[model samples]
Target: MSGKAIVAHANLDPYERTIVVSDIHGDNQGFLETMRQVEFSPQDALVIVGDLLEKGEHSLELLHTVMRRAQAGNVYMVAGNNDTIFSEWYNDEVTDEEVHDYMNHRKNIILREMALEMGMSWQTLEEVRALKAAVPKRYAAELDFLNSLPHILETEHFIFVHAGLKPGPLTEQDRDFCLTAKAFGTQLHRFEKPLIVGHWPASNYCETIINVNPYFNRNTNVISIDGGNGLNRWHQINYLILHREHIDFGAYDALPRFRALDSQEPSKDPLTLGFPSTEAEVIRKGETESICYLPAIDLEIPVANDQLYNYKGKRYCYNMTTYCLPVQAGEILACCDVEPRGLLAKRNGMVGYYTGRYEFLSSDDLLLKKEGKQP
Candidate 1:
């Protein structure tokens, strides 16, 4: 398929609502729940802001689900960065050498996991090449659908794009600006239309917004609805409802899970695990006791002889053999510091240092905690 400009105009009646969502990344369950919560009907329009494929396990399924919906009702999608990359691969813009290099040496654990899910063996570059060759054949329909997606969709009151447009009129914007730009150079109030986007997570701009739950930039007329789905357990699928003269927010719960392949060895590569690196060495507190960070699992696994060490009002004792502790997704950890390292935490009952951030906390649970209520 050749690159083409797809600009769709949605003409809706007064009672119809336009629901926009972004960055699904293959969270099929979350997407279904969002649809069910809204009680989606034939009258309501659905707009996806991109990054629909990759990362999660059910990307192919999610693509089919959206395609089916598009046939039945008004549904539109903007091509995202991941969609662009996959398009390149499908259109032969991505060479076999590049795929080989990515599979063998690239530090992108998510991509590697995705390749494994697509039937590529993790052992060799030849397997990567085979998978690349077979993808176009296996997912020809999906690839064609992805390649056909537009970069921008405009209406009378709103400009819906995967990311943000460049610093000019919509007609003058390029594909990169629409599909990949992370931030608008200036506030979009000059355009006189609200620009709905998904790419940057709402949590990234939480500090600046009064209601961080749905991340809206009132000054710019830009609304970001990506809840970081597929990034971790803390994020969810967020949807923005555009009605007559108003916009509302709806979120669906999305919990992170260990990728099928990564679940087996959750901490095999500490450097490429997408966490910050630290140089703090293991210090031996005394004989048969050592305070150390395990590179395999990205957690501080303290070792003590038989007595407890009191530090910062938390008691720590060695419970298992050194370098044997394992960490997985969905495990709750009480952390004292949000830093990548140097955290005093408790999992179950044992006390140690947790390296993961509270950013992984569920949004619904966080709201309850903030309101002094139990979830």
Candidate 2:
């Protein structure tokens, strides 16, 4: 949040593929099980959605796995609110004494209260305690890596946020803390591009999502993969895969080489959100097509030497001789060009343009429902 030391990654191509995981909550075994459910390849990208620490067994092991994957050039991490808090304490951004006091005095009661709220029974509460006792200290290098995490990751087709963005085009000013906080029950719409998130666990959405992670906003492009794991009695671990090309759907119906080593089992109910069971099926499905409800209206008026386009009281000029207009009124105007040179347009005399690399999406092509307008 403070420094450019952690420069966020943004890719112009929205269709770029990746995977997301959430709220590991320190169940290393659950994390491994979740990984087993999804198909991973050397070419694929992996992202940890957040809540990677606190009140879970083998927190250190989970961190180690993240580090290992990152070192192997496939994984990325965003700091969840809890990740941030523990990290702050771990890095002395929050005092060690403060965390120690909380762990000593309020840890058990707090775990029980949260578990009850999350629907854990007394027996499950013991599991949470057992998980806590199994927790080990984190490595210093991993803390540095966590501290260096990005608040947002952008691809050509999708964006991954720790929690959810505040809405609208992402900007540097979007606060990191808010980025990782809760967004329950708000009528938040997914971006025109897909948004992947993890924080809240999903118990009811299994057959669709495979674990505790909720898939509520998948229809709208907001996927929350926090399958509560150690935090919920359900004890599901989950992540998702997006593919460049479609794979077979039949693979999901087949059993895996390994069922979960833990007590957690798949729910009897069918997953309502349409998650493919195995990685191959996800690949076969390709990327989900995003529907943008926003319409495009082009304003053009013919003129001899120079012509102008106006929309919403704004004016833009196109020169038949030298340049194309970059904006018509308030709407963006794209340049038409040949292959040797891509789209070229000038705005406000700055001569703005993109060549060979820019991929433009028409407003009509966007998943353009206004924020808070979608279910």
Candidate 3:
């Protein structure tokens, strides 16, 4: 039951257009707003590549939305690693260490979110055990929704899976492998058709620049669409629209919006970005922070010292960043924070640092502006 295939097939022939997005991770407003921006309609097939739940503030709400939309029959979901996390735990498929890792790794976990919704809490193992007992009855509807999700949705032109596939026919791949495969973009595979996947962020493969647009590896015919959502300061919900063999993409973020009043040239110096970051090796230790080496750019930078660790004899920080982005005026950017050093922002769907003046957008309208980039 754990490793078997739960394949779901679709032709998508009836839909006028098809839209694919991945790894929303509970950014319900961003997902809904982007749906509005894309002008999604009932005539369209909305294919979510996976990781729909967990790691954000609104998993339950987002789940409700997807569930409601799915009833209309045009919406399809491919089970993601996170999407099946609930079933994994409830079924006792994970060890205690795995449970600890899950608890410590994410903030705003969906299970805890659901537990809170049911007037319960899960900060410790005891609470989790109690919730496990209560969940089958109390959270039956949500659990059924999660359990019923398929791992693959194959259409005529594309194979939509949350993770990568191994070589073979669609019916041959394991459900868990399809849901948990890592770095399928890097592997060599002879696919029957073009494949689209999430789980691994597109940012991981963008070495020279900070980009999160849907990545197409024409060599292997695999497209990676995870946009670093729910995992970093710079991220978006990436959309991939399909029309026959042609493909189009864009990204949306829930970050604070800013509009530029004046233009500035990009940094002339050679800069390294997102060599698939949020992980780095420590080069030197300091009192409050550590100097770390990012392997992708071969650059060393300072990181907070508190999180450095050794796993299986290799050193890595749980979180790391070396983002420096270019900016332009009159365009909107997703602003992360304003520090004395500079402004942290993401523009044109690329996440990085910007040292420029920008105007803030009113949260309600996203149109009003005020001159500021200073903290």
Best candidate, TM-score-wise?
A: 3
lDDT winner: 3
Over 4 Å off, model 1: 1-6, 101-123, 184-189, 208-212, 254-375
Position 17, candidate 3: lDDT: 82
Task: Indicate whether candidate 1 or candidate 3 has the larger lDDT.
Answer: 3
- The candidate with the higher lDDT, 1 or 2, is 1
| RMSD list, candidates in order | 12.4, 22.8, 4.2
Q: Write the per-residue lDDT of candidate 1 for residues 90-209, one digit (tens) a residue.
A: 568787667677556644333455555675674566776677677777667766888788888888788888777655666666776677676442345545677888887664542211
lDDT values for all models: 0.60, 0.46, 0.77
Q: How would you encode candidate 2's per-residue C-alpha lDDT over 162-195 as one tens digit per residue?
A: 6667555566435553354564314356558766
**Cα lDDT over the full model 2:** 0.46
Better of 1 and 3 by TM-score: 3
Tens digit per residue, CA lDDT, model 3, 178-281: 98888788888757689999999887776556677788898899999998888766678889889866789887776777787667666545354432344578
User: What TM-score fits each model?
Assistant: 0.63, 0.50, 0.83
Q: Provide the lDDT at 80 for model 3.
A: 93
